[model samples]
Target: SLILTESRSYWLASLTFLLLFSLMSFRSNKRLILTSAFILLTAGAVISQVPVLKDRFHSITDTKNNGSNITRLMIWKSHIKAFTEDYTLTERIFGAGDNASKLAWRHFGRAFQEVTGKEEIPPPGELRKWFHGGETHNLYLKFLTKYGILGLLGYLFFWIYVIYRNLERRDSLFIKAFVAGYVGFLVASFFENNFTDAEVQFTLFFILGVNFALISETAVRQR
Candidate 1:
């Protein structure tokens, strides 16, 4: 898990997959499976309410809490403003190109200073060392900032195309599993840079490949 949000996404997706698997296996016991799922969910909810799990499921819209969500929003705003305010019309349409997210984060640091004020960050010429690392944290923004609107649209088109092709085989177990995993990645990407994460990226492509394999095998059998 790269972060709390990503971890939650993974858990949710895995749980969903397991439930589906159970349902598929217990075709005659659908009612029993549904009852079990409900009970499990209720127990999990109660457990998560304990003090030990206080911050586990942080609110997505919380602005007052010292959660990473706020800073992520700031980074999003910073990059959007950085591109819109500074870039020329052509640059906005075509993007600045290469490591643009790195530059965007640099601007994000300044944006934080301006938005949050000097109190949040150390004052200029202050005698204190600061360690900071920055990223767009959102893959969509990262792509848009690095490659502009056209780039974002093209990436989305390819993504939707692959998923659409796989979805045509709704009867395939592997395809259903891949869809669940893909949806998980899509949800997680909103909160973290899942595309840049090696584990997440590997898992995403692996599931996709498995779906293709299942499709091919089915085709061969049918022929």
Candidate 2:
């Protein structure tokens, strides 16, 4: 399903999860490692042989052929530009408030037009298509744009704390899987607004809740 989606981020994320989880769980078993490698290679070969998937995978780094990638770059550019240039000091610290990126685009949107020498404003249709109403398409950038430095820091700290808790009680395989999933989510967040994605959030938080419950159960057992 992930392969069929043709989403580069999801592919990378799933691969990262597989690699990390395998390393953490199966690294000591030579037979399992060999089997896993063979399976992964076979899967990769099959995926690469499919023309649609093959082209899409190759186009990930093909600047000229990927319009969506180029658009993502522009969106990222505008976001960074807005954060650096347009945000006030208070706004930078506390954020310009929720959904402020929508308004911030007005400033960087003109900057983009000036640089490209195109009238990129007020068709409403094109504007909506181009900016997607100020979505940075990046979880980190989205957090920064919505909640400022403090908010971004708080978010990062929360993740770090969760990982720390997992490490503190490192006996559970489920906890290791949670860590792997978190790493995959981090990779996906670079190319997506996964923070606001309901499905992703639900899965992530569900795993997280289970992890916490497992941790508490272990503590009770130890006591």
Candidate 3:
């Protein structure tokens, strides 16, 4: 259900991490993995030249965002406005509730109109058309609106800690793989909702778990 560009970003980033791992690996199978990746990358690039497939290349840097990005921008602006002007101190400090931004947008539709200088309320059908299914596309903003500064700080530091933990040991193949994958995930997350999507979130945790296992084994070996 994700955009083609988004899926490409995720998988390409993963493949890149794996490819680098193979290049650096001493294992016998590294050559096989490298050969396979090269073939697929080459085939995929050639296929993109087909008339039906060329638009995807433009989509990679499309500032207009194929319509979705503008809608996201509007929703983000609306949410930031509502969070600042429409909520109580307690609600502001602790957020309205978990997964409640959509609800906030619904309840605070008037606030959005006021902030955006559009006084007309859409019909119920129209409401579903424009505002439904929108979340804070950016996770930091989501945290700021949901759980205030403390939550935002915690969220930021969590990744910092993860990166630090991985780097504490000598860089091994698995460690390099996780770091590269995690870096890509972070970059993609800024533009999309990685946490809300089940598959993306699952893959994120899978990366974390692999890193944990790798780091633990390395620690045991050192002992």
Clashes of each: 0, 0, 0
> How much is the lDDT of residue 97 in candidate 2?
71
Indicate the residue-level lDDT of 165 in model 3: 90
lDDT of residue 31 for candidate 2: 63
lDDT of 2 by residue, 1-223 (tens): 6788989988888888878877877844456467658767976897889999898888878744476776676677777778888888888888877647665666655644644456845565665576766778788988887789999999999989998998887656777778888888888889998878789779878888888999999899999
In terms of TM-score, which candidate is stronger, 1 or 3? Answer: 1
**Per-candidate RMSD, Å:** 4.7, 2.9, 5.3
Candidate 1 regions off by >4 Å? 1-43, 46-50, 98-132
Please rank every candidate by TM-score, starting with the best: 2, 1, 3
Measured by lDDT, the strongest candidate is 2
- Cα lDDT tens digits, model 3, 1-223, are 2223445455555555555556545364566576758866774676476654466555655545455544555667667776766777877777766655654565545644553456887676765555646576777777777787677788879988997898787357567666656666666566666766889678878868877988999999989
Instruction: Write the number of the candidate with greater lDDT, choosing between 1 and 2.
Output: 2
TM-score of every prediction relative to native: 0.72, 0.86, 0.68
Error of 1 at 66 (Å): 2.6
Q: RMSD, model 3, all Cα superposed?
A: 5.3
